[model samples]
Target: MVNLFSHNISNSNAINNIYNIIYDYASLISGVLSIIGCSLNLFLLYILIRDKQFHTVSYKLIRISVISDILSSFTIGTGCLLISYEFTYDGGIILCRVVIFFTFTSNGVSILNLCLIAIDRYFAIVKPFYRRYHRRRKQIFYLSQIFVWTIS
Candidate 1:
């Protein structure tokens, strides 16, 4: 692998090789994750959209989570793909920053979306009094999508 290549090179070359290797690994992982995430998201979306009875607060949150996951997957995956395809980053400084920013923001949004789902479930199960609070979960789900976009 690149590690073996690095060991045969001089110090500076080794450093550069290490960077390339890390970048390739990141891209590979991101691509794989995105493929899986997108597949599952599509499936979940199909199920939700097809079943009228499944349109509940819980399903609303699930849809939101899947959307977030899909976005996260694509942003991260595309950045990684670009890095792997153009090892020297042909996109230049602005794109590099943009890609990195999106990667981080999507990851953060995905995590926060999951956190929100957990909170919603907790309220649904443990705080029965507040279950009614989530009667507007679908609207809040849309609002959360907007919020995530604004923050990101």
Candidate 2:
């Protein structure tokens, strides 16, 4: 019969090798995508700044989403790269927690901002009058933006 302890050790070594391969490839891919995402976000920000017409509530939400997407892309690459180094190293677990928290939190914020944009579009369409007095609801819009960032 095969020795159980030796079998377990061999299996664990195989798993560790697989993890290293996956982590290295994942980090490489994530780094490339992060660079692309950050560049796109910067371009969008430039347009948001230069264009006067795209400063409405929905567009503002989209801007926020783009910003958070940039943050998320950065954090995702960071987390992947960190994991590419064995996570058991000194202080690695805490670093991972911090990196992963920001990654997920920014992603959550981006998604929530998209949802807010959808809601704004719905109101603009279903309640056509809602578009007429955006200035009156400006404070509410800002508050909702704050709430979205906060909750996420």
Candidate 3:
């Protein structure tokens, strides 16, 4: 019987219908975004890996960012699609936790890499002498990339 005292409505047809509509729209948006992100990431990876000259440290950092974004999109975007299609919490707790962790970690890493890139640029422009006197820009960039990945 319906929980009349608790004021919980027994007929949830309206709520369920609204949810279905929203989920479909969200799935469409997520799918489109995932495709775009994956395509851009693959293109970047191809440009960086195929051309030896593009192996400069700066490009390497960008490559890492692209990889992380691709992974993030795959996990989070696909999860959203599944949820939309199933319309149920079928992923369970473990899968849900793992997906969430990867999503958060990858997003954080992507942002951190961008921040490091900015810092590297500032150093390059502000202190040109330091680049020459100390480690080469290429080496410094590689080291910073490694540092960001390791920390992330």
Candidate 4:
């Protein structure tokens, strides 16, 4: 009975080892992809900010979205990769809370920015009159972004 029990334990350990190996590989692949994606986002953001001609309301919204995407990629994507590698949050509750907060906030900002962009486009194409008013009140766009960040 003891020998049988030992054999079963060894099999379980082997299975767990295999699982860990697979998880590590997956985490590595995901981490690399996330880094690449964030790099592209940063490049786009740099181009947008550097080009004075693209300094319009729509581009501003796009910039915000890209910033949030980069944030999300760094925060949430890193968190997931760490988790896959069985990294413990030895830093205590505060660190976990901060990570969670930033991940959620960044995702929220990205979604809100997309919604704002869609609304702006709708106004521009569907109601030209409203679009003119929107252009005149550029402060509204800025305020909306502020509101989104605050809420997030």
- Output the number of the TM-score-best candidate: 4
Kindly report which residue stretches of model 3 are placed more than 4 angstroms away from their true locations once superposed: 1-11, 87-90, 131-133, 136-143
Q: Using Cα atoms with residue i matched to residue i, what is each candidate's TM-score against the true structure?
A: 0.62, 0.77, 0.73, 0.83
Give the whole-model CA lDDT for all candidates, comma-separated.
0.73, 0.79, 0.75, 0.82
Residue 146 local lDDT, model 4: 90
Across 1-152, the per-residue lDDT of candidate 3 in tens digits comes to: 45773455534766888888987898778877887787888887898899999775556778888889888878776766666665445555655787688788788788888887787767768876774725766676667767776777
Write candidate 1's Cα lDDT for 1-152 as tens digits. Answer: 99977767778787899998997888788778777777888888899878999786666667766676776667666766666776554565665787677667766777667766787788878986764566776677678767866776
> Model 2: per-residue lDDT, tens digit, 1-152?
46998999999999999987887888878877777787888898889878999898888888888888878777766666666665676677687778778887888888888888877778778886765646556777788888987898
Cα distance off (Å), candidate 1, residue 116 = 3.3
Better of 1 and 2 by TM-score: 2
List candidate 1 segments past 4 Å from native: 1-26, 87-92, 127-152
Cα RMSD, each candidate:
6.2, 3.2, 3.8, 2.7
Model 2 / residue 137 / CA error / Å: 2.2
lDDT at 27, model 2: 81
- Model 1, residue 135: what's the lDDT? 76
Tens-digit lDDT track of model 4 for 1-152:
99999999999999999998988788778777888888999999999999998798888999998998898777756765665655556743555676689878988998899898888888788887875666665877978989999998
- TM-score, structure 4 vs. true: 0.83
Ranking by lDDT: 4, 2, 3, 1
The Cα error of candidate 4 at residue 42, in Å, is: 0.9
